[model samples]
Target: MSQLRLWGHWPLFLFLSGWCAVAIFLDYLYAGIPGRKYFLLLSGLSALLLGLSFPPFGFTPLIFFGFVPLFYIQEIADRNKTSELFYVYNAFVLWNIFDTYWVANAALLPGIVAIWLNSFFMLVPWIGAQWVGRKIPSLRWWSFASFWVVFEWIHHNWEISWPWLTLGNAWSSLTSWIQWYEYTGVFGGTLWTLIMNILFFQFILNLKKQLSIRKNSRTITLILCFLIFPVLISILIDRNFLAEGKYGEICVVQPNYEPHYEKFAVPEMEQITRLGRLAEINLTKDTRFILFPETCIGDIGGPVNSARVQDDNRIITFYDFIESHFNIPIVMGLTTIKFLRDGELDSPFKRTNQAFKEPYEIANSAVILKNRLEKNIPVYNKSRLVPGAEIFPYRRLLPFLSPLVDKLGGTVAGLATQKERTVFEAGNLVIAPVICYESIYGNYMRGYIKNGAQAIFIMTNDGWWDDTPGYKQHMAFSKLRAIEFRKPVIRSANTGISCFIDARGNLGKSLGYNVHSSINQGVTFSPYLSFYAKFGDLLAYLALLFATFFVILRLFRYFF
Candidate 1:
């Protein structure tokens, strides 16, 4: 009963208090740490402030100053020769706890790992920056900026890749405020944020020293430009943008199937029947396409050949409905598998005892079914899989740990993915079929656009995270994709908040969370590709380059 009271709606309170106590105890060695308790308080408060800026709260502008407190602590640590890693790591852990505590709603153990592991990854750059700065104090700011940008880059590209807290993602809710994403991508936002924080850190330092306004005039001007310039650019872009291109209307179905009790538990035929009814309500004469959320196709044994996929009663039901009722195409998520030959490219962790006669199971795919064509339906397997839930990271390297990893999350073995991005050709409209979580990757999404996807259709199942910011933030990030590529986006989620967003990131039509509904909405297609769509994460690459240069230069100087 006592334990129940402590955890009831206030588990975070208990966790935070414990976290602070642990931090205080660990800082005993640095007891003479300048800014002592104030530094610790600043760290904790800044984490809280920054965490609140993301998703649900969406106080985006606060992110600009989020790191100021830490930078202050860093400055003091540097001058006093005190270790800052312990404090920095704790601050990041607090940030992760606040921003992604909803992860616990999915699974408790993995959620704890995600929060702590992500905090550790975030701590990497700070440690590197401090180490480098100790040698070249004059170049400390540049070192800090470079380390952070490089960390964000590494997080996005590596295995166990969870870039959820990449600083730029803070503006996800404020799509209109980040129109310049077309030019630099989210890494541009990262660069902009670090620059602002550094400028403000300098401003605060100057203020402490009673420096005259004239003495710090240049830094002040820079701070003003850093704050004002991005928003100004975004506003100008938002004002002038036009979505004049024409496209067929799309109908998105939200089956509102509860993952915990209804989705997998319910009969496939019944789920399909209900989905058809939802589509029927929303289907219009102008509707050229209808989309269903991920894994709504239920489960199938192994991969059915394209020619025979419609032979399956479950898939045939939807195919027949489209043939008998409307000329429009339907796309949906499926759990599918494919057979591989003895010498074929199999999963890296394939069993040696398994016969070639036996087929391997693959999951998480999207398929397109249109007018009664004899040809096979085009299917694209999801590539950007969730770390623990979908793909066990570095399975080939750590095959022995599969059981341990799977028990912590969802899968023992990861799903297989196609090497190239697949674009579904539906008559005049070519669609990019993006699965859930795949939508978060801008560079990966650009491949579909580059392959001639006029517009994107994202199918997701957000039911696992419940009605938390997980779903809302997922939806908000889709808006950023729309702005970055200047293309209309059609999103269909398993349970709710399914929406149609225009090229300029404006909402067209949407269904609320937990609502069972569908909507037919017009979407414009653009042949126009933004700089980001063409160049892809150039800012991140440049930042990496800068970091490499600094590291090499510092090493040379240190040895000499």
Candidate 2:
């Protein structure tokens, strides 16, 4: 009986032994590469880690290791002679969906296109890095970091520009850790993140090989230094920094109007009246300017002429309200139309009215209405437009896609943009009138500072994303802007998170999401420019130069 029991257990033992052998053999054959399921699982883990590093979830430290799995995947593919594109693309697609799925809440078809298309664009740098790695294996890590930074810089300047996920943005919520941004801007954070991930991945590889402690200690020490040095420097900078300049009281109003159901559905006067009521309650005697959200006045009687914005009844009502009640300058956003000149060359952005047969351009613009009479309002056309919603990218080259863009909830005709940053002046107060989607660009924001903007006023309509992390993430980005320029930021959102960020990137009292409210906050302006404001994305330019040099070398080597 004892002999029979021993034989029965032999099958289980044999099964375990066979499993271990297969696992060990696979690891040896593929240089520690896992099976297909584990590969995908690692990609998913990377996506989750990256997504959690952004707002709401805000596991910021996770960003340091977010790219480690991606490096591992690339290593596996390189060793096993398999295509890494599929797995890399899978990670990016999952990341885009995880972080910005709230975009679908605004427009479903366009939102899906934005997510998938943006993910595809993200693969450009990774693919470039992989190609360079094949040609020049020693510079693989350097090429990866350089290509990514170049990609980010391109994203900020292009027509389909979406730099929201620039790795540097992860520090927005934890501004204390990145006070050095005032000198290097966001690109520095991007480089730091890429380097740390590369080093950490290398350390993991060393451990897997069971390398001697002497060999691994240097990498371990380097990792610790990279992790702690920046934060220590940032803390030191924060401790010594002092914000100084002119002081002014500004009122930010959040009139909780649902963009889909309520904002445009209600009468234009009714919306104006609601804004006035909120401003009236919050306005103080010392308030220098009253800030309103983007497109606060819907339709504006079929897009008031940009040349004669003051003639519009909505503008007249706004001026009258200010004159009668407080006589303070009101900065608000609306749509404006400019008819093309007789000799003006036709452009893809220009549209013609079927009845009039004359070309005109529409702009998502901001204007200031003051008591003083002026022939024309100082209007700032929003320069940076949302990819699908406001402007169709490459519309000129692919006119046939216009209808597709329209069907997907995008403007068939793109909005007009101005060439330079325009700052609005009201008495002693000077502000950068940043419209929705314009606030995210740190280098672009520096233009306002260079143009002599003392404080930044951001006018936005966050209701499109409903009550989700999208609005919160948008709000958090403004904090980074505050630190980058060392200037106070005043925000007025159509539905929520209307608040103030001081020079130190500290958040003040804010109106919650979907609430009709207003708050009066005193902001101290900074006349002096920060290093980032003066120099402007030098790191990005260097990265671009390096990436270009590597590409040239790779091509030369291939031909030779």
Candidate 3:
């Protein structure tokens, strides 16, 4: 199936493996010492590289998974029992690499490599915990469990954040086990993975010394059950969910028009408008809402403030067209501009951290257009931003990054997000809009449901980097969001894989990553809610607090 078949593939695999080795080595360099002067500096660089893995540059696969064995070797070779702590910490820290970007190959060998490399240090903590279990004797397995989850939570919150590949997501293939995610969230899957890891490690460590077949056989049996029981049960019980199908009809627009090409290009405009028009025309009468990918428009400077610009502006012209022609409400990802000082409409250029000192502000934004009514609409700017491309973390310190900042090519800091999800209504439908890259953050998604969003809308531009796992992982994030909120999610991407996620988190259908493919599919609308929707960030905060205190106490014991 791969074109590589024509090449001497065995050597190709070696070359690919060599590339991975180098990536892992660079990750090591980026993972500076815990208390070093440049620790935060390396961390920032790490996050940028992590975010770059998403789009417009899809290098995440080789670098993230490729060279990870280095960390394992380093941790294992360290003679000091405590020395393993930093290495264990570093592995997850480097794993933050995979969190922010999803390479297209994450489902195949490349993806598996990334997962194993990211998780290699998982064994570090498991071993150290077993050793410390003898030394300090704290609460049993939950200590390591709590440590890992808290570690994951940190990466789950930043610009370079990627939370899609938790060992728990692996259970997506093991449907029966993950069915509980509808109630417990994906962490449940990760927790099970930890338990199995512990069991297997212990079983192997004690294998040769055991004298009798009975004890060893029983341990082996327990290990097998630990690994397989959840998977088997998960597959069987998924049917129960399928039987009580409460599906919705929603459509998503994947305008395969690339953004690097000017959106205002006459031909591009026709194509985008045509796709939106087609979405409007093809909607089933039952379709509750329609979604457009993020910034379906290609050009940056001209249409910055499309939503709330001059009264007779071009932005409004597009809105007026959609409202007048389409009977169904449309939720779209749009880029708009806002004058900073409330001054003249002209672009003012100011210099801040050498980035967007320019007067014209570009924000990655989302707008809701309710059928044929275009006045006084609700809009939300993306709160969290991508580091290199959206908002650089420490631009003030990195003076040389001036050109790099300008390259993100959009508005800096859209709006000071209210830290709350805002909602709008369409013919009894309550639509919540999630901008590109923000869907991966569960806390942000949950706030929308808590505020009353019966259906979720996601707008993204995956073509920035092509059909990498970044796009697939983006879709996976939407699936989890739907499961977490107990509401349907409709995602539209510029390149492909546009899809509708059901309230139950099933993929109804999707568009391919290939060029020029337009997709129309039904999405559901429902008020079905979950524990996570009702109690947003409560569990995450609690986990954070516990890990903080435990780590502090351990630090005191070790050095203070």
How displaced is residue 477 in candidate 2, in Å?
0.8
Ranking by lDDT: 2, 1, 3
User: After aligning candidate 1 to the native by TM-score, how far in Å is the CA of 170 from where it should be?
Assistant: 0.9
Poorest 10 consecutive residues of model 3 by lDDT?
Answer: 1-10
Residues 1-560 of candidate 1 have per-residue lDDT tens digits of 01111122243554567777788787765676565656778888789778987886889878878888888888777677666677778889999888776666666677777889999988888777766776787777788798898898888877798888888888877777788988888888888888888888889999999999999898899998888888999999889887766578889999987775567766787888889999999787888899999988645233444335667667777778997666778889887766556686556433222544555656688988875554667778899987887778887788897786777765665677888999998776888999998998888899999998889899998776666677888888888888888889899998747999988777789998889889998878777888998999888878888888878878977998
Q: Residue 119, candidate 3: how far off, in angstroms?
A: 9.9
Model 2 C-alpha lDDT per residue in residues 1-560, reported as the tens digit of each score: 01111122232244335433554455345444434446666877898889899887879889989989988887877777776576677778778777777776776676567677888988998889888989898788789899999999999989889888999998887899999999999898899889999889999999999999899999999999999999999999999998888788998999888777677777888889999999998887888899999987737357878888878888889988998766889999998888888776466578887855678888999999886488867999998988767888898687888778787666878899888999988786789999989999999888899999999999998877766778999999899899999999999999758999998899997999868889998989879799999999999999989999999999998999
TM-scores for candidates 1 onward, in order: 0.94, 0.91, 0.71
- Top candidate when judged by TM-score against the true structure: 1
lDDT tens digits, residue span 1-560, model 3: 01211111232244336544655565576465443333333433433443344332435322232212322333233323324333333444454343522332211333333344445534544554444444344443445666666656655675444455554444443243455566556666556655554555455545646647676786678767866786576566456643222345666777665444433444545655666665765576666566777865424334455445324244454566555554566677766655456453332222234445545555667777654345667767777665445565454566575564455442333233435677878777677888887887766677777777777788887665444445666676566677666676777787647776776667776777744444556555567667777665454466567656655666566674
Shift of residue 413 alpha carbon in model 3, Å: 5.8
Candidate 1, residue 217: CA error in Å? 1.1
- Model 3 has a clash total of 28
Better of 1 and 2 by lDDT: 2
Evaluate all candidate structures by whole-model CA lDDT and list the values in order: 0.80, 0.84, 0.55
